[model samples]
Target: MAAMKSTLSDAARQVAANALQNTLVDLLGLSLIGKQIHWNVVGSRFRSVHLQLDELVTEVREAADQVAERAATLGVPPDGCPATIASAIALPVPQADWVRDDEAIEIVTEALHIAATRLRKRIEATENSDPVTQDLLISVTAELEKQHWMFASGHAAHAQ
Candidate 1:
């Protein structure tokens, strides 16, 4: 499909593109982290936590695609390079080694929270200049919030 021509001014498109790029980076990082946790999580809750991390990984990857495509529509090249993502991501990198279920839960929850918080700012950043971008970010933010809640709830239950 042909990319949609953006109606936003160059300056506005630049701003929106930056916001989208930032979101894309964070989402990519989150997806990788989710996968890392999925692959390495151990403990009595292994099966459930592993499954949940897979779901989170899928969701974040989808969101990253949407954000990157949106940026492309605005004539911005979306950067998904490892170095770019590593440097631009708002969340801390979890340990590379195997992690227990509780540690995995904390790591993923923190990353999701960071993504959601940044996405909220992006939503506001695009509001006046690019309503469509704002709406897209709003949708992403909503999903991240829901995912965060799901993880948080599970973490609470795991703690008890």
Candidate 2:
């Protein structure tokens, strides 16, 4: 068997940086989605959902910062203004107005689930080339997925 390569190159690092920039874009996307869900949630679970919204956004915002910093570490500036995020994100169409509590939660759950899945793949890619980065993406993905399931099931229960 051939011996493993010594390490990634500067060009490889730049490629990693580009991927990191993409991750940062998703981070901004996810954070904004969380904030939107929190802002628009309604229904019988008002207090619970609304209260949890703040926590969701708080965590997502932190994750966004972490991803941005990771991009910085890789020498790529994270380009994530609201417009950029809106342009880049490929999530479902969100309602401009507040949705029924269940709809709001469901939309958010799906979006988070998608983000988590995407992040997991990005994490794996960065794992070999950049361990420090892989760690943050892994942690963020796990948390988002857990939250996704929680909200998804809750939304479903409300419908039943």
Top candidate by TM-score: 1
Highest lDDT model number: 1
Query: What lDDT score is found at residue 120 in candidate 2?
Result: 78
Candidate 2 per-residue C-alpha lDDT over 1-160 given as tens digits, one digit per residue, 9 for 90 to 100: 1123325566666666766777777767766776777777777888888877677778778887887876665656677787887888877646678866777787778778777878878887877777777787788888788888778877788779
Candidate 2's TM-score: 0.85
**Poorest 10 consecutive residues by lDDT, candidate 1:** 1-10
Per-prediction TM-score to the true structure, in the order listed: 0.94, 0.85
Position 68, candidate 1: lDDT: 92
Candidate 1's TM-score reads 0.94
- C-alpha root-mean-square deviation, each candidate: 2.3, 5.6
For model 1, residues 45-118, the per-residue Cα lDDT tens digits are: 99999999888888889988999988888878899999998777779777889899988889888888988998
